[model samples]
Target chain A: MAPALFHLFALLTVASAVGVVATKNAVTAAMSFLLCLVGVAGLFVQLDAYLLAFLLLLVYAGAVVALFLFIIMLLDTQGQKNWGFKKFPIFVSLIALGLLLTGLGTFVTRGQLDAPNPNAAGGVGAALKPYAYQLFTTYLLPVQVMGFLLLIAMLGVIVLSKKIDGVEDVK
Target chain B: MIDFWSNLHPVVQGLIKGLAVIMVIFPLAGACSLAERKVSAWMQGRPGPNRAIVPWIAWIPFVGTFLQRLGVFHLMADGAKFLFKEEPVPGHVNKVYFALAPAIAMMPALTTITVVPFGAYFNAAGDAIPLVLANVDVGLLAVFAVSSLGVYSLILAGWASNSKYPFLGSVRASAQLISYELSMTLSVIPVFLWINAPGAPGTMSLAKVVEFQSLPGFWGGTWFVFLMPLSAFIFLVSLFAETNRQPFDMPESEADLVGGFHTEYGAFKWSLFFVAEYSHMLVGSGVFTLLFFGGWNPLPWISLADLVGWLHHATHAAWTIHPLFVGVLSLGIFLGKVLTLIFIFMWVRWTVPRFRYDQVMKLGWQKLLPLAIANLILYALAIAFIQKSAS
Candidate 1:
């Protein structure tokens, strides 16, 4: 049953992922993106990484998709003509796609490709205790680095936005 | 009740429990609509919806008039009207998402109930066991994640309306919900930090928070609201915004937005949105009760076990320890607190004027979010100091 469930989640992930790329309407594509995230979260749960699943759902499906839809709704007004395939963009997209496939191939060969048995105990991410313990101990330096990076990015944005205030003529 | 409940197969038991909670919540959500009307009317010095009555019950005279005046029968009338009314599809709207939004609204409202431990049962040894549908380790987080999906329904309804007001309302809703969610999540961190002290096995189960409240000492038995009052205040404010209750109900604030996201919606679809809103309110109040108020504990510094023991001593009753009786008593206390919180929700709705849109945004971002962050940092420092000193 567990293996069957895992296969079902994988199917959902792959199918919705295709839907995300194929859908024409920007809002529809955003909704498909949400479904893809949900399917990925389901796969995480089947792998017994409940915390990772919750984070994926909460962060991606919850806030990120909402922001995507918000922008799509604002920018892509109804009855607007869809952007046609331009020459330079098409050439760039092809290069990007080639790079993506190459990265996928390398990762697939080196990553944890075999699924753990259904009854096997999950690794660190299974329960809150070990995941949090490892986070504060072994992974503390990387976490701090990520935090500082995000802080710097946030400060940069704040500076860029506020810099416009004093230079504007309207006020 | 315990034996019959335990005898069922696990899957069957889960199905039955889910159905039971849904059944209770659906009508309760409906009744909340009527209660809102009555509450607003009472505050404004008027009788509200006191005319509807069943024909056969009219023969009972005083009792009939009493129920009529209480507007009890209007609940049935309103339900029938919504079911029978025409569901109109606007000519210019997106048909699929317009229809899907209400159903989507309901999914999270009902799903969050599975993780919330509402009441407790005591064994012969006086150990209080929480009665919930699924007490997963990732309890409160699951509730937050699922309920966050509710914003999708509002956004869809607004965008699908394909017109001026609804699109605007959806825009406001997307911003309001995302902003307030930051404060709500941050505010609750203090409670969890206090509960998940050093050396304790880590868990995020809501029942464990309540169990901590019920311990036998002064500090242990005290509710978190008294200890972390600032966190509780921030959480309550964010809860109002998250549920889209009045003052912060910028999504469907009828005054300017003209019915907000549901402007293009009516009849059964409209009623579904209201029900979903009420259901969210119910679940939010239940979470607040478990987090800040004592879950099934009747009073401050008085745990459920203490109450049961006092009753046993006072009456010398052998039946006080009966699981059925204890369960009912605890359930009553829990539900009573939840209902009181719901009433407070309505009371504030009637008394407080709605905040201006800019004011709402400023409060969420500038005031509440910073307050929540500061509250978290303060609690972290205090808790760490205490833990280190103890060792």
Candidate 2:
């Protein structure tokens, strides 16, 4: 049951991701991206990293895709639509596709997929607990440095976005 | 109940659990909105929502009853108002994408809570009851990946809306999330290293990490907060920006983006964005508790073994409440911690001023990234030194 489910999800994911890159309409492509994200989240679940799977769905699908939609909407590019690729681009796409297919075929034929090692100490949940422990103990300095870095970044963003002299407003 | 019975397949069960958590959290999110309003109101020295009372009930009730019922009904009324309001689809926008954007924004937020283990599991009649929806080993990674997708929703909404303000918001969001994502991931690497130091032999599981800290001495069995205060602080601040909370919420700053990425969104669709925001906050806080606060472990240093020993003596004969009950107790403790953290999020949101957009970006790139990398290096050296000294 698990293998079958995994296969189905992988097929859908890869296919949609391809569609995302291939589709001409930007809106259609964005929709394809959504499907691709969902498929990736499913794969995460299959890997037993439920937290990562959820994060994939929550952050990427939720915020990132929505951002894409907002940009597409704001652009209002329908009136200026350009449907077909130029001849040179088509040739390039075809060559790229061929290389990708060959690479995938080689990977499949090699049959070197290794099973998960159960004897490994941490397993899936291993990182979660110790991550907390080490953060406080061994890695304390870097952590403080990170806080400082964020503080600096925040100040930089503020300065950049501000209205400075001689800068023309885009709008 | 009957409908639930009919839909009892594993997938359905999973969906049901997901929905239940969403249902529980949704109202909580609504309450969060109210709390935001109230906190800001208090900060500014003004009354907030004292007059938004239950129609007939408030007139007939005493203080306690009226306040209790009003608190409960407040979210319902807010939801109903949103539902009944006219949903506007602005001109020149792609209708389908516009409609779908909100759902996209909300779905992942609701789903991310599944792997958050609020409690432990127990077996009854040989059937194990896992506290979480799914207890996978790579739970933390799953959380990280899912949260990362949230940025896309804002991107899509901005693009599909075909408006300038929304477009700018999306642009900012993309650059912001991507830039911060590196540091966010890097900041946590030290944690992973500590969990799986050399000779540990196996990956660090969440359960085992908690177990290791539950040793008997004063320093042996305590929360990691004391050991790595800096990491905890960094993680918390980054978490705020990662979730797009205030002081870090440049994407949706009303003064700047004019509603940010979802400026064109209205009615139920707009509400979905809020839903996603609150849900992300909830999940983020839950993970924060799990990672740094000793997850579900009460009294900081308390361990399951110690509890088991105490329970064995306390109940003596009629210890009928199975080990699962103990797990549930621990989970309850964990949930309490998460809620407290969430409250802190709300408190902070109302207290701080929003960061300027460029400031938000600069903080992520210039400061957090380098610092996170430095922390990772420092941790690596420390671990090496400790191993050598011990041997």
Estimate TM-scores for all models.
Answer: 0.93, 0.77
RMSD of each: 2.8, 7.4
For candidate 2, write residues A108-150 as lDDT tens digits. Answer: 9987666667654245433445445556877889999999999
Over A71-164, each residue of candidate 1 has an lDDT whose tens digit, in order, gives 9889865578878999999999999999999989988988955665644432445458777777798789999999999999999878766756
lDDT of 1 by residue, B231-319 (tens): 88998999999999998989998999998999999999999999999999999999999999989899999999889888989999888
Whole-model lDDT, model 1 = 0.91
- Cα error, residue A11 of model 2, in Å, equals 5.5
Residue-wise lDDT of candidate 2 within B111-203, one digit each (tens)? 667667667644555322447776656666667766676776777788778788887877777777767767767766666666665556444
- The superposed Cα distance between candidate 1 and the true structure at residue B53, in angstroms, equals 0.5
**What's the lDDT for candidate 2?**
0.73
